[model samples]
Target: MSWRGKRKVEKPKSEEETSSNKNPKLESSDDSDNLFVCEISKNRRVAVRSWQGNPVVDIREFYVKDGKQLPGKKGISLSMEQWNILRKHMDEIDEAVAENS
Candidate 1:
């Protein structure tokens, strides 16, 4: 038997299944609870949010879905420690950007 013939192909999820599988925390309802939110661009944002009972700095891209802004997978969440470390090196980062530009 060919290896390809043994592979299992999964069917795509239905609309109802896809919608129901979305992470609730990524929904717009959570926006009101954010500590701070700044739109870096039309579809990008930076926000401080309480995640799993701890504060986190979230830098994420967003997409419009059903008239609501939803977080996209291309993003990063930094813990307080990580945020502080990044903050401390802001000058260096700025210098690097300046040099590159």
Candidate 2:
């Protein structure tokens, strides 16, 4: 038996990755989780995520300016209606933050 045959290599993928990739774009669990992440800088970042089984929302901002994790503002739970209202004002909120900085 010659060992010169081209061997097919298969890359291992996690269950989460497989599920997300197999599902339709709109049906992705991550999208439904009400999670959003944005990079503010090389080390600064912001994330918005929903609480378990609730419409409650949370926002966190952090950074790693110099190998250390820098702390930032954090917000807690919010009502579903309140979240909707916030979404509507997202652009304005961003602008306000930018103006403040």
Candidate 3:
């Protein structure tokens, strides 16, 4: 008296599909192509990202979570003009740091 043969079994995935599914980070993705982010120092990063079809740069500190570096809530986003102003200030800041050294 057996009655357990009415469910449809799922087809097994191919090796490539299985491997890709197992490691999603290795898949070819272009979602981040519009955003450029990099670490400037420990716990610090600079990101050039596009928002509303406009390019913006952001500088901020980051934190580690789940063994990955994620952007922190504290950050500054700058427009092109603001970025230029920041660059000028950065040059002065660099000289000041060098003078102190």
Candidate 4:
């Protein structure tokens, strides 16, 4: 007898079943002072949140570990001053991108 013939066929799961297994992390907690959050990709996000007593813009990459999403080391937190400077230079940045492309 061929061992391949003894394999069991598994039934396909429904959309609900498949969807229930996917747990996306929340942008902020109940007590968190997050102003905004935007997902740029499946694992990358940009968020404005309060740190200590000051607000900072955080651009971070998240990873799934033990069924939970955790921030990875590949990220940067910009202070308000830095964020403002970046915001002011957006037009120049756009021009550079347009030129490069």
Candidate 5:
């Protein structure tokens, strides 16, 4: 056997990386726990995420500055409990709208 110094060494691939390589758009399990943005309007959106192991919902405003839609200063982050309360009220609004329709 000749000297094997010509062999290239490579670090082991992570489980996530190997699976993702088989499918470029493969979303890992961790991605499910990530923030999901829900568009509310043309210049506004909501993001529900987990921060520091706590559930949170972020409501933010967007502005078109220099033709670039960017986040504005108007924003609020609420805990899961607060979000549940707001969601309850939103359900009432949904009921009213459905009744009108």
Candidate 6:
């Protein structure tokens, strides 16, 4: 007598079920939608404020690993669209600085 005959077989999960368990949400947008790029440490925090004394946002987080960019734990986050907007205005800021200098 074969011992296999006494063993019970398990059914495999469907592809849809397997996928759902892996990634529950295929569409999600949060921090990736904001404009808060770049992280600054306590020591380097002054660097951010020194930019032409212009007003801007500064986000601090503890989850961010050293040497890592923003969007870190408590760090700023920016979406692709937000980045594009800033990039477009960079030329203007550069021009203003050049004129003043």
User: Candidate 3, after superposition: displacement of residue 24 in Å?
Assistant: 18
Q: How would you encode candidate 4's per-residue C-alpha lDDT over 1-101 as one tens digit per residue?
A: 32122222122234353235443333443324554355666677676666767888888777776666667778888999999999999999999999999
Q: Which stretches of candidate 5 lie over 4 Å from their true place?
A: 1-34, 50-53, 96-101
lDDT of 6 at 25: 22
Candidate 6 lDDT tens digits, 1-101: 32112222111234444334332221113221122222233322111111133333434343223443222234343444555687799999899999999
Summarize candidate 2's per-residue lDDT along 1-101 as a digit string, tens digits.
Answer: 31112111112234354335332221223335433333334434333434455645444444444454543444345677887998899999999999999
TM-score against native, each model: 0.66, 0.32, 0.54, 0.67, 0.46, 0.27
- Please state every model's RMSD to the true fold in angstroms: 13.6, 15.1, 16.0, 14.9, 16.2, 20.8
Q: Note the residue pairs that clash in candidate 6.
A: 34-78
TM-score for candidate 6, please give it.
0.27
Clashes of 1: 0
Model 6 weakest lDDT span, ten residues long? 43-52
Clashing pairs in 5: none
On lDDT, the candidate that comes out on top is 4
Superposed Cα RMSD, model 1? 13.6
User: Where does the lowest 10-residue lDDT sum fall in candidate 4?
Assistant: 2-11
Residue range 52-73, candidate 3, lDDT tens digits: 5566786767676666555577
Candidate 5 lDDT (Cα, 0 to 1) = 0.55
lDDT of 1 at 24: 22
- Please tell me which model should have the higher lDDT, number 3 or number 5: 5
- List model 5 lDDT by residue over 3-90, tens digit each: 1222121222344543343322212234344343455666665655555677778687767655555556788879989988988899
Model 6 C-alpha RMSD to native: 20.8
lDDT of 1 by residue, 19-101 (tens): 34332233234333354345566667676677767888988777765665566778889999999999999999999999999
